[model samples]
Each structure stands twice: as C-alpha cells, then as structure tokens.
Target: MNRKQEETETPSKYMNQMIRQQQKQLLRLLRKAGVMPDERIEVRDSELLIGLFSQIRRLPEFAEDKKKAAMLMHAMDTIFKFPVSRATVQKIYYRNKDF
Candidate 1:
C-alpha cells in the first residue's frame, strides 16, 4: 500500500487494538464482580452482556465504586460503534436470559 494508505490505516488498526484491550479489561472486571461467569463471551451475546453491565453499574454497590463504574461506561461506549438503545438491550437480555 502507499504511504498515505498506510498512514490512514494505522489509526484504524490502533483503535481496533485499543478497543479489544478495553473489552478484555471489561470482561475481567465483570468476572471479578460476578457479573459474568466466563472469561470468553461470544460477540453475538455482547448486547446481553452490555445490558447486564448497565444494570450492575446502576446497583448501589457498583455505583459507589466510581472508578469501576466509569470503566464499565467506557467499555460500553467503545463496544458499540453505533448507538444501542436501552430498549434493544433489554430485549436482547430477555431473549437470552438462558445465556
């Protein structure tokens, strides 16, 4: 690729890596907080997990921990490139309750 192409692509690549790292961190936090059972969660189930995280963040226990709550919010914001509505999250959570 040309230098211009490489330059343009580098930021996108870096951003993707950063996002993946954030996701890993978020997963660790969720597991530590007993919000997730496993270290590896499917991408398709992300919406459900996001909804659960949102609920957990709202809990008095998590709310009191500003740092963790902020991390969760950041993770949620980074995960969805497009805006995801609360109603959509709730629907995903309900539909995948068994997950």
Candidate 2:
C-alpha cells in the first residue's frame, strides 16, 4: 500500500463500509432510533448482517405486544432505549422482595 492509502484507508475498512451501505439502507431511517454501528469488520455480506442484527435488544414488531403501558410517558416511552411497561418495571423489584 502507498503512503497515501495507508494514512487514509485500508482495503478491509473500505469493504466493510461498502457492505454496510448496501444492505438495510433505504428502510433504516424508518426504524425507531435506528443506530449505525461504530465498528466495522471485514466480512462477507451475510456475516456483516449477522453482526448488525445480533446486538439488537428487542423482539421483532410482530412478536411484541403493541399495547401501550398503563402509565404512558406522553408520546415517548423508551427508558434508556428499551421498551418496558410499569408492570415490567415492577418485576425488576420482585427479585428483591422474593423470599
């Protein structure tokens, strides 16, 4: 690699960027708080896709219950980016009180 290429970019980095853009680009913005990964890997499209989706913390829309929480927080309900209801929140404390 030339000095200019070494200082500016590498083949693997270039490939990962291309792969990310190619898949899930058009519909990504439509997703709620869609976030791009800060890191990229030199892998095939299928492997890169696995890395992309493996970290998502939610169930698919079809699998989730669409009903809103009894205690809605106006129009926004995400607490640190995970959807939860008051009942679900209450469960967080159950472990402490359980004997």
Candidate 3:
C-alpha cells in the first residue's frame, strides 16, 4: 500500500494490539482475583470487564479484600493508561460511583 494507506492502517493496527494486550492483562487480573476460572481465560467484552471491576470496587469488603482490591485497582489503572478520552473516564467513574 501507499504511504497514505500505511499511515491510516498503522493506528488501527496499534489499537488492535493494545486492546489485545489489555484484554490479556485483564484476564490475568481476573484470574488472580479468583473471579474467573484459573484453568482458562475467556475473551470477554470490555464492557463486561469494566462492569466486573465496578462491582469489585463497590464490594462492602473492599477495604478488607486486599487481593481483590489490588486487582481491581490494577485493572482500572491499566484501562486508564490507554488513550481514552477524559470524558470517557469520567463517564466510567460516574457510572461506577464507588470508584
């Protein structure tokens, strides 16, 4: 492809790779938190993962559930590290009020 086509494709390719990496990290975190089966990591939708994090953060035992809390924070940090808009993050925070 020409330079213009390459430029357009590059960002998409990078985004896809980043998304895959993020998904893997999320799966790891879920497994570590014992929220998912340790034998296999399923590829779940981002929204589902986000919802799980939300619930984790809202748990009454969050203060005492160190492992799960740490995993939830790590997942949130990883997600925020991506190039998402501030508004998007705000929306997430607002939707998950406990976070």
lDDT of 2 by residue, 1-99 (tens): 568777887656767678768655643653534564323333334322332232221236412533332123211222223244435443442223322
Better of 1 and 3 by lDDT: 1
User: Which regions in candidate 3 have their CA more than 4 angstroms from the true location?
Assistant: 1-44, 63-71, 79-83, 93-99
TM-score, one value per model? 0.31, 0.18, 0.31
lDDT of 1 at 32: 91
For every model shown, the clashing-pair count is: 0, 0, 0
Q: Write the per-residue lDDT of candidate 3 for residues 1-99, one digit (tens) a residue.
A: 458868876556667799879989998999899998655233335445555676766678875676666676665755444344535543563374542
Query: Where does candidate 1 have its weakest 10-residue lDDT segment?
Result: 90-99
Looking at candidate 2, what is the lDDT of residue 73?
A: 24
Each candidate: what lDDT? Answer: 0.63, 0.38, 0.61
Full-model lDDT, candidate 2: 0.38
Name the candidate, 2 or 3, with the larger lDDT value: 3
Summing lDDT over every window of 10 consecutive residues in candidate 3, give the lowest-scoring window: 40-49
Error of 3 at 83 (Å): 7.0
Task: Give the per-residue lDDT of model 1 (tens digit) for 1-99.
Answer: 458868876556667799889979998899899998653323555565676776777779777887777676666654553245646654553342442
Predicted structure 2, TM vs. truth: 0.18
